[model samples]
Target: MLSRARLIQRLVIFAIFSFLLFVGSQRIPLRSNTVPSAPSAPSPARDSSYERQVQFWKNLHNLLESNSPATDPPERLKKAENVLFDPNANYTRPDLFAISEGDVKQLQQVHQRVVQKIKNDNSSLELVYHRGKRGIVSAAGRKYLPTLVISLRLLRRSGTRFPVEVFIASQEQYDEVVCEQILPTMNAVCIVLSGILGTNVVSRLEPFQLKSFAMLFSSFEQLLWLDASCFPIHDAIEIFQSKPFTHVGLVTWPDFWSSDPSRFFNTIASKPEPPVSERASTDGGQLLISKKTHAKTLLLASYYNYYGETHFYLLLSQSDVGGSDKETYLAAASVLDEPFYAVNEPIRSIGHRNANGHLDSSATVQYSPTEDYKLTNQGINHVKDANAGPIPHAFFLRTSYSKMSPVNLFDPSRNGSEEVSPIRGPDGKPSRAWTAEKETIDSLGGPDVEREYWSHVRWTVCTLEGLQFKDWKDKEGTCQQAKEYFDAVFAPKDRR
Candidate 1:
């Protein structure tokens, strides 16, 4: 997690970079000499005419699909030019990213290796990248990777599953992120959704458009959206529950949007009066979205988050933009009244509707009864480290729970073990661990060194003095205890 002040500063910087890129993309000449590098067995991204034009001319280009092997391909712009120019576009809105020094190199090397793997391969299932997504987000010079790309990269690198049919407003940024890091991790590819940011009202958005775009991609009803940040924490399946989308579900909480109105988009949203119904809570971060089945609600939610700029500013003014994706999503839900079923206890559903046309939110549209879910629940810990998404199912959906799996770390005792042991390798001297362990005190969300103790301690134990992992098997060291340790190390003078 990042502090408000530091996140604000970095976002300001990245926003500048994105703005420059956006401007450059629209204004620069698409020189024919500029070619997007294509690797063998490519995913057809760079090979597409739209990509060709984008690479050569930093100008706005449309992606055109071809039916014939030979002859002139028809030029079709997937995203509208006017949409990009709309100051009201949702891309500028708030969302979410950084860290330390010696830890920077390890992250970079991991990132570079991923990038190289993608660049060298031409599989239709290659990973995606964005050109602008370079440099370490955790530490200076260390590149922070797009969670989606990194997630996919980890999946493919481990040979989990593939033929990822994702939706891209345009594959430009996708290719860019992939090219930078997390290339070899792509398996197969299929993108069948919008490629650009929707016509979201801009004034009310979070001011960080790229995050909006990324989240929109997450909402594309494609990726399983495994929770991760910069590094691949462990081995897990990308679990492309790609079966068709059956219905949309929301975690019903009692009075979440107590005082707000604004259903979703400002163009057409009412502020929350006093809330309604018995249930109204939603994870709003992790989601299992799909366009094929009955998930129009998800689409509707996307529109709210990516609508014309009018609603963007409206939403931002009322909300903190701190929860980043989660915050925006909840605000939209409060305003949109999109149909979502409540999942109180866990594992309550499993399949698609048999003779259903579309889903009726009133009746329980379930794959199975909620009583059957038996996945181990590391509830407190997992929920704490849970990735931001619409629903929280993926936390331990199919995977076994380990204490360290963010969601499972709530109990200090079950801090779970590291997947890869940080052993003193062949070179003797405790092998240097690749990590993001150190950062300037200013950046770690701390005014004083001790305030950032948790991050520091975790950083120290995970990587410093040779990478030591939290061993759940041993069932030792509680988080509270760790805090005590942190206080001792950083601020011993004022202990109570």
Candidate 2:
């Protein structure tokens, strides 16, 4: 009954309204749930690899679950745990470190299963390793990310072309932006442990165990495992072709502290005690290992680490300093009678002298594994006499104090009027972070090395402020201070 013009107007308005609604819905942004898959995870090949990884974890988990003391410690072993073997006092238990015969038998069974599993997976390494066969691996959780970034940036700065894989142990440890976006720019990718192991397996994993597992899970046949704070002073890629890796397939650096593990660990491993000369403990900061050659060694190391909390860690370290996972690798190789090169060069410390005449150490400088290996084979002894060995080629500078993070480096108390470290002496000049002596500086890489190091640290602080960590509390102030310090110490004009 309405007029034709009015009816036409109503239809037009309804049609326009429907069109607007449809277009608006189309333009609406996607929630994270609907967002595209992570950049590193889109490939069908990647999906297939993940599935295989899940199966591998499951298979390994079942084997360990049945045998692990965490689930079922033998009755005698439980009783042995109650009986403390005091190293300081004479104790009658021949099985020292409180390890029982039952413990040994169980460990052996687990070892056999673990060995078989490694053999089974050796062929499938091709599938799991979506990245190249020779890549660097590091474990980085949230706490370690900033230090890791500093290391990674320095790694690339060192002119190394090898790709890297950063392993995060759980979903909790993963940072989506950093992993998916930032790392890829550095030719690195993040591998999530929980994604591969599932909740059941990941639940029981310890922080210390992640390093060995990272090496095992990494696609690379040849790997350099570096700690989050460890930085290479030279090109790391060259080590792969060098004799240290090519000859022995496994190489470890020395630590300041001697390993002095209980004699009972030898009995447990069914191997004789190592010679006094070889008792130097592993640094555990940097390692070069070939999975193709040391697959069993890696697996055994993982086993020792997995049970580290309850047994092997104490047995290996006897509660010694520098004790976490430090001894597992060499011990594993020894137990299997696998050939490996242990660096003979004594680790040296780099630091500034404090007001109290004490050295405020910052890092431990470990010599090049390749150079050390060459010297050792030539019948040179560095540990006994510094002059007897090859001229030390400083390889890794592992920061122990004063990490390269902005929060720590630019801390007001450490660098301001109330400065406490690298103190100003009577001359009223502050000592350099690494060293003050010209000869030591030249030996520890070169005159330009500290410049390179500080430049990297400056870049990390200025660029990564948006990361907004609690440690980097005053991002603006930290960045400003970092730039000023770099300008004063390492800027082009300050170059010596």
Top-lDDT candidate index = 2
Q: Any idea what lDDT model 1 has?
A: 0.30
Local accuracy of candidate 2 as per-residue lDDT tens digits, 104-171: 77665665666556556654432245443788888877767777888898888888878888878776
In angstroms, give how far residue 43 of model 1 lies from its true place. 8.0
lDDT of 1 by residue, 17-89 (tens): 9999998878945433221333212333444443442242121111111111121211222321111112112
Residue 293 of model 2 has an lDDT of 75
Instruction: Let me know the TM-score candidate 2 reaches against the reference structure.
Output: 0.79
Model 2 stretches with alpha carbons more than 4 Å out: 1-47, 70-96, 99-127, 130-132, 401-404, 413-431, 436-438, 467-476, 492-496
Task: Give the root-mean-square deviation of each candidate in angstroms.
Answer: 24.9, 9.1
Pairs in steric clash, model 2: none
Number of colliding residue pairs in each model: 99, 0
